[model samples]
Every structure is written in structure tokens, then in C-alpha cells.
Target: MKLSLGEIADRFDLSLKGDPAIEISNLASIDQAVHGDLVFLFNSSHRKHLTDTKASAVVMREIDCTDCQIPYLISERPRLTWANVAKLFDPLPMQAATRHPSAIVSDQAIIGAGVSMGPHSVISAGAVIGDGSTIGAGSFVGEGSKIGEHCRVFPNVTLYHMVCLGDRVTIHSGAVIGADGFGFEPNKGAFVKIPQIRGVVIGDDVEIGAGTTIDRGALCDTVVEDGVKIDNQVQIGHATRIGGDTIISGCTAIAGSTRIGRNCWIGGAVGIIDNIEITDQVEVTAMSLVTQSITVRGRYSSGTGLMRGRDWKRNIAAFKRLSNLFKRVRKLESERGD
Candidate 1:
């Protein structure tokens, strides 16, 4: 989709400093942009490329356009404006309401208008797929599942029994929703399995990334609230409640029964243990381990910063001798006492 500079400015409420007639066909990074491409300046490090950018028009904050030779659009939030523009040019295909020849949908299932099913996709008995939803190739919708309107379940995705998805939800490839939680009872030197009966209820506008797994609850529903964006390979355990608008980055593992509050930012590879509560607007940095509850709303981080290998080894050696050093200091203090 081609958009003129004036239309973008009007749509996004950005102040137009460029020629309104200039056509923008695509988006690119400032350093890599070519002719007919729209570039954005958000980071200070990328400001060096502003004068040399080959794009037709640039999007940047008003303060950064002083040295810009080319036409530009002024935005208070440049990155957000860039995202909105990118959405206008997104090239994802829209499938019609047709089932592939290899697709197997049960007669007992209720399929809504404008729904499409790809090859080898299966919709089990009592499954309800809402209007304009797409089930991609090799995907599975298990018994009693309900998918809301305009949801996209990408190829190889699995919706286990009784799973519920809200409107405009997007589950990428290989996402496994409503799988059984890890529960066992130990008796007589052996373990017995505990059945996971409850479902997973995902709220509206949630985007779950590829290869993510959300386990079904043992006692109640595993709930992911509205507008939560989960990055790839995240593992959310059973009965965990992720509050609305929380952003969890890649490789984060949230243990069972944890209650994460609204608008929290959980960084990549962060480990959150079970049964803990994190309050609203909390931010946990990457690689941090959350072992206890967070009641306050602020940024929290753990683990040491990266250093040279030799320096780390020296710190480790000093850490090992701390107890011995403390004992010697105590002895010296006792001898000095009159």
C-alpha cells in the first residue's frame, strides 16, 4: 500500500514538515532506507544517519529535524508513529471462508461466517469458531473450544480441550494452548497423575508468540488478560494470572499459580517462581529471578552485570573467602579489646 506524506501525518496526528505529495511505499531503518521508503528516528545513536538517509521522507521528533536536509514528519513519539505506519503496509494475506480439501471439521462444530480452514486442520465436535477466523495448516481445535471473531491461529497451532480465545487474538505457529499442567501425587515410592480439567481463557487483543506454551489449570482456568503480548518460547504454567497489558519477553518461565499484576514488564529469560504475587506496573529486568512477591510498583532487577572472565573469576575467589575473612577480623577485634 502506497501512502502520501500528508495522509500519514493526518492519520497519525504527526506534524508534517515534508512535501505532502511525496509517496511512501515501504518502511525501513534510517541507515538502510532507499528511495520511496519511510524511515524513523527514535534512538539518539541513529541520529547520525539522519542527514545521509535516502528515504523519501523521515519521521522523527521535532527536536531532531534541525539538521535534516530531506523532508520529514514531526512526531512526539516517533517509534509509535512508525509502528502505526508499518501496520498500514503489512502484507499478511486474508483467506476467504473456505475449508481446504484435507481439512476435517466435525458436523457437531459450529463454524461462523467468513471462517477459513487450511489443509489437515481439524475442528473437533462442539468447537465454535467465530466470524472471520482462520485455522491454518496442520492446526488442531480440540473438543469444546471457543475461538472469538477475527482470531488467527497460525499453522501447527494446537488448542486443547475447552480452550477459550477472545476476539482479535493471534496465536503464532507451534503455540500450544490448554495443555495439561504438571501435577503429580507421590505415594508408595511412585507418583500418580493429577488430571488437569480446567481450561485456558485468553482475553482480547492478546498476541502469543511462536512456540509458547500455556498449560491448563489444575484447579481453575489459566488466565491471560487483555492486550498481553508474549514473546516467543515463553512457558506460562498452570493457573497463572497475567494481568492486562503485561508484556513478557522471550524465554520467560512463569511458574504455576503466580499472580502478575497489570502493565508489568517481564524481561527475557526471567524466572518467576510459583505462588508469588507481583503488583501493578512492575518491571523486572532480563535474567532476573523473582523468588518472592513484589508488592511495590517499580523497576526490579537481579544478577550481576557482565564483566571480563578474569575479573569474574577473581570476584568468585573473593566471594569464597568472605567467611574466613570475617572470622579473622572478629579475632583481631577481640584481641584489641582491653
Candidate 2:
């Protein structure tokens, strides 16, 4: 998949500032690029590494050409152009409508045209697989579930019964969708389990990462709106409604019955408790615990920032004295009034 510098420039409509005959077999980072590799420079902070890069060519703005002695393509958005070019070098394999003999497809299931079911995959009874969808090896599509067009259920993924997925949804390996939510009632000094009868509804273009689990609700369905990107190891509890275009990072845990608004950015390892409403465009910082409802639209963070050990100890001491200090100020004000 090697491409000449001139060909790339002409394809992307970028200004060519170097030898047209130069070729690159692969794309790489600026620091790790070797001979015959393409690199990119977007931030000025990375300009220091440009001189040391051994790439055959680089992609950068025209102004950066002054410091770069190597052949480069001048682009308005170097990263976007580089990403498009990288796809050319490493294209994904196409999956056709061929069902592997090892796959188990139920006669009762309705599979559409151009669907690819891989080896050892199971399409349960009464399930509907839309056209151009790919069920990867060892995956399980449960009974009565509906998978929409062009969806990709990656290897070993499990979509439980009654789960619904929209078009172009990508579920990665080890993801468990429509599992039972954790529900119990204290009855006669013992915990009684509640039945989870709800399904999971995933909208179009939603990409769920590996090992993520989206639980089924106790009564209502768990709804994830379109264009949501969920990262690896995320745990979403039952009855949660995720708005469109929300990006959730890795290892985040959201409790049950929570409503996450549109275009939210939830950082890695963040914990959100149950029954809280997060407004639109809210950005939660990494590792923060959300204990209450976020009514306004803005960035939010909790816990203390990184500090030296001595400074942390001093802060802890001051926190302990805050209540006493408040009382003392109140007493002083009362004496002044007297």
C-alpha cells in the first residue's frame, strides 16, 4: 500500500513541497517514524522532534516548512489528512454475506441479505439481522433480538434476548448487552431479587468498546442515543438514558436510573451514582465522583489535585479546623453587634 508523496498531495489537495517520487509504506508518529514512514506535525510542541524524525515525508502546515528540511505536504489539518492516508495503508478486511459452516443459524431467525456470520457464531431463534451486518466468530445474538443494518458484533460479543441495536453500531469483543440489572428488596430480613424484564436500545453509529456491560432495566429499557462512543471496561447500570453524541472514557461506572444529557464527556474511572441527572455539554474530569445532580452545563471535577505530601497534610489539617473557624467568626460578629 505504498503511496508516492505527489499522489498523496494530489489526492488530498495539499500543496506538495518536496520530491514527488518519495514513497511511504506506512504512517507513524513523529518521534517513532523511520525511513519510508509518513509522519505528522500539528502542535508546535512537537516541532522539536521534527528535526530528528527519519520519516520519508511529513504532513504539516505551510508555515512549518521553514524549519523542516525533509519533504512534506502542506495541509490545513495534518492529523485529519494523515488519518485518511493511514486508512489507505491499512484497510479493514471486507466481510461478505457468506455464513461459515461452523456458524449456527436458527431456521426461525430472519437474516437479511449481505449479512456475514462468522465461524461458531450463533443467531438465536426469532432474531433479526439486518443487511450488511457482520457477526464475528464465537459471538452470540440472543433470541428475539434485533440488530440493524451494517452493525458489527465483534468476536465473542453477547447480545442478550430482546436487545435492539440501530444501524452501523459496533459492539467490540467481550461486551455484554442487555444483562440483568442489580435489583433487590429487603423482605422478611432477606434480599429478594427483582426480575429484569427490560431491554437495551442502542442507537445508530454507537461504538461500544471491549468488556463493557450495559445492563437491562427492571421495568423500562436502557436507551443509548445515536453517535455515542463508549470506551473499554465501562459499566452502565439499568434504566439509564444516554443522550446523543456522549463520549464516555474507559473504566467509568454509571449507576442505575441516571440520565446523562447530550454531548457529555465522561472521563476515565469516573463514578456516577444513581438517580442523578446530568445536563447537556457537561464534562466530568477523570476519577471524579458525582454524588449529586449536575443541573448546569459546564466542566466539573471533584477531589483534590495532586500535591506534595507535606502540602496535602497541611490541607487536611485546615479542612478539619474549617467548622471550628466558622463558629469562631460567628461568635465574633455577635459580640460586635452587642
Scored by TM-score, the top model is: 1
Can you write out model 2's per-residue Cα lDDT over 246-267, one digit (the tens) per residue? 9999999999999999999999
TM-score of 2: 0.92
Q: Please report, in order, the local distance difference test score of every candidate based on alpha carbons.
A: 0.95, 0.94
TM-score of 1: 0.97
Q: Model 2: which residue pairs collide?
A: none
Once fitted onto the true fold, the runs of candidate 1 whose alpha carbons sit more than 4 angstroms away are: 327-338
Q: Model 1, 97: alpha-carbon shift in Å?
A: 1.9
Candidate 1 lDDT over residue span 50-164, tens digit each: 7787889888887788868888999889878877888999999988889999999999999999999999999999999999999999999999999999999999999999899
- The list of candidate 2 runs beyond 4 A from truth reads none
RMSD of 1: 1.5
Clashing pairs in 1: none
